[model samples]
Target: MFESLKKKFSRTSEKLEEELIEEAEAEDNLQEESGSRFSFFSFGRKTDEKKEEEVVEEEENLLPEAEEIEEVPEAEEVEEIPEVEDEEIEEEPKEEKKSRFWHRNKDKDEPAEEAEDEEIEEEPKEEKKSRFWSRNKDKDEDEEDVSADGEAKGGIFSFVREKTIQEKHVEDILFELEMELLQGDVAMEVATEVVENVKENLVGKKIKRSNDITEYTYYALKDAVEEIISIPGKSMTEMIEEKKAQGEPLVVMFVGINGTGKTTTIGKLANYYLKKGYTPVIAASDTFRAGAIEQVTYHADNVGVKIIKHQKGSDPAAVAYDAVEHARAQGKELVLIDTAGRMQTNTNLMDEMKKIKRVSNPDLVIFVGDAITGNDATEQARKFNDAIDIDGVILTKADADSKGGASLSIGYVIQKPIMFLGVGQGYDDIMEYDPEWMLNQLFSEDEEIVENEA
Candidate 1:
């Protein structure tokens, strides 16, 4: 039932329904005054026998037996306002030739002056009718479809406004949003938070619109993401500077399950240091993936950073030893040792990753996780953090995940600052993380989340 209600929000349909209901109620009210005549049947009344027969047929079918129509004789000076006459009203303008009553004599077309007086007197009533109909043609604006203090849904079905929204429509919009989020495989909590916040922002305002709603939604999402990544954790540069200032070369290690892009991130990290005027030396410590050594070597050569490698199937610790000696001799500022992307599920591999850390003695141990794997990334972070101390997280392929739930929730789960992001598959795919900008984009729609929470 909840899901069913969610897909029914149609802005065009809302407007159309409001107009229709008002029209129906107005028609019913007018019919009450006219006695048994639908407003539509008011025009084209005729005294002709054929017309009388047709009216009788319609009256028989529609008129309720509980109410009987009785017509009192018209008073000489007082009578209900004559109904609008389609043909007669138009002919009434030419009152100078009053042949309205045909007596089969010349007196039929004789008096035009009296007819003119009657027409003049009826003019004001006609003007009043015209004004009333014109004014009532539009739906009532005072019905109060949506209000912040009111119920989600109210007196009217599918009611909403630029200021307030119907409860059903809110459900509809939020449900659709939730499905989209889940289909993108966002974390369940992430999806729930988005739906909850979106509803809070959407109600008491016109969503499915541009203006404030669109901007509000974007900002709301941006803010949530920003909050997630905006941990007051230290950065790679800060860590490196702290280490170097204390007369210690910063050693950083990367860890994750196989095929999680751990080694690629290591190359990128090495590339980052080389550009920072810090000659970074990399260790091909990942012996699992066949192309791991060559991958680091390729990026290492391309970045003008040398990598320490050994023959395939060689012990990873051996390469780490050579890499550390090389960095120490060159007086390098940072040592980024790429460890095997081994599954933490395998106890032996987890032990190896731990042993490698002891051998390398890295200052920062970052777990490179895939953003597309959703909560699995969180579990991987936890597992790696348990196996070996994880200091921070480096989320790769961030832009690839559309829902972006992983990027947002990972920081909270892991309790670490996301140092960098891999946006695309370029050599310069890595970029400095922007917590504030990301938060703003996500929570841009939420004034409360962006301003009040700040």
Candidate 2:
């Protein structure tokens, strides 16, 4: 289904992831330098504190020497005093000694108090330094917490912005992705939409600890593709059954450009209903082509179903009217009408198609397309839909298309459900369309089983 797209995206992811990891590593190196600078600042502050403590210790050692010099001078003064004033001098010395005793005690108390005050001041300084380091640690921890929070916010579908994904890298990736899509045959508008979606998803988003950048990118790609192809509509079988319940034979008109297997798809559709136990009638309204009637008649004979057709150059609308009338008379449950293949730009042919649609009043107008034609098929589908307002689509040659971009873009571009796929060349080669199944075929790998299935 989308095998080519998957391989292309896988290569892109590997390339993008390699670049992002390199950038992240460079950022980590810068962070390491910042951490080293903070450590150096802390070391310098510790050295300054050590020098101040050494100065304080030297001042304490000088205090005792200065006190001894003062004591020697006081002793000499007592010896020089005369006998007449010996008693007074002795009393003076005693008074001096008493004052010295009181002064020494006060000096002793001052040293103890100064030491106590220094210890008190040093405790707060140590506490302040501890708080400074603690704050730095807390800041680092907070950064980690924020990254975790961002991952939580993104959950499984998106990524939250915490650590910025480099915009330059994203732009580069988008450019490469666009080129790849174009090379794979995706329409230009669809390619641009895909790139925009991926950019919106990944730019500025935080990379989770448990996830990789490549993972985020892959999610965005898958989401964008599924959104593009998954048009909201009723299931094919359900619509058919609903129309059947109305008690009128369900008429489906198939339209497409030449060589798109429109006639073969109608035959397959008729065979499909026959297996389901419903009477089917084939209408060969492609009477303009040389062997269109013979082609449809061959399918009718192979499937053992009734066919309403006319000679070449007959009115296609008249052929459709006869087919519906025959179905109602035969109590048939389904009518598969094959119209002539013509280019959408052919005004005359387009008008003829409109007449057939008006005359038949088909319950469903289906546009058959070739998956191998890629953008050409999509453009044709758009033109046909614009002209005749098709209800759904049936894509032929799906198995042969390696790129398969048309199948991915048609439904989204035209806002129509793709009802079936022509996988091979047989009446039983057709399969009901399943969006999930298509996705699985595109993305499923052993390593990505669940996500690819999704």
Candidate 3:
């Protein structure tokens, strides 16, 4: 009897479960269609219990079936409705996994340490990159016109090459050249320009041999000389002929700083005149210096020429006047007056030289100059030219160490021909100063052997 009650009770519960599910599904469907006032989950527990008791009562009163109903399979009893796993299940697992991973990885901080290490390494790299770019920016700009600018290129190499004085020792070469130019009395502008030009040429050059350096210096120096001395001047023969055609016995004079061979030049000129068959009469007007007259007299005797003499401290103008007078009386073709060697800038002495020229009324006034006076020689030539309108230059001491370097300036400024040269101490030392010969002497590489041949 108890077993039958339990069976009735289990069947009643199963029927109630099915009815509740169906009712809930119907209510859900009705809500979707009619916009229902209440949800299916709002069903009360007391109403559901009452429905269960009624289902049990109806099950017991049901008549016995004539035909048996096929039993539902066991698999169908747990009807799989997508084997529903909650989406929240996945969310919970993801959250649990994240927390567990964080807890486990907390002790293994190698990833964070590696990231810090990467940052530290990157900091120095960035700094080094900034420095490298900063240093090479200027060189990069220079290399933009690489064909034209042969300078240090970009990078640490350029800095090292330029600052460290490692560009084939160019800095040393330029430094030494600067010092040498200063000692040579080169003008600051000229010297600096030369250095700049040469530096521009050599900035990026890779000169490896001594010969290249030597050639470079040679060209640089040669170019400077050419720049200063490019002007052409009057020749001594041209001046003489021009004056001689105008009149007989043109008066040629010598002027220079003392000990610049002014007196000796007068003698050499007389000898040169004798060779030209011009009857030369020497004027002994340099009475101020001891042996000035006697020295000229000795040259006169050797060259077999006539000379006019006066006592010491005599008026030079009077001596010149007498010499001119003697030339006219004897039909002497040329009169070379030996004047006193005085500072060309001295006012009184320059006045005296002017007076001598005025009284003599010379057809041509030849300015005998020293070729080895260097820069001062240019100044001397200018002073002498300003004094008496110098007709030509007789550059003496051409064989000296200075090698007529001053001729370029003197000749260029005077715009007159160089007439003669005093190459040595003797008579044969006196030779016609040829322009081409002088150019060779000035620019040539061969050693000039200047003995006292005269």
Best by TM-score: 2
Best by lDDT: 2
Model 2 regions more than 4 Å off: 29-163, 208-211, 446-454
> Which model is ahead, 1 or 3, in terms of TM-score?
1
lDDT of each: 0.61, 0.75, 0.57
Q: What is the TM-score of each predicted model, taking all chains together?
A: 0.56, 0.68, 0.51
On residues 403-438, what C-alpha lDDT tens digit does candidate 1 reach at each position? Answer: 565676677666777788887776578887777655
Position 11, candidate 2: lDDT: 61
Tens-digit lDDT string for candidate 2 (1-454): 5667877776666566556645655556211111111111122234446879999999999899889889999999989978888677568778888999999889877887888888888885454334422222444332332221121111111123224576787888789889988888888888999889988887877763214565676677777887877887776567667867887788889999989998888888888889988888988899898988998899889989999988899999999999999988877888888999999989999999999999999989999999998999999999999999999999999999889789888888888999899999989999988887776566544323212211
Error of 1 at 293 (Å): 2.6
C-alpha lDDT (0 to 100) for residue 5 of candidate 3: 16
Candidate 3 contains a number of clashing pairs equal to 7
Worst 10 residues of 1 by lDDT: 34-43
Q: In candidate 2, list every pair of residues with a backbone clash.
A: none
State model 2's lDDT.
Answer: 0.75
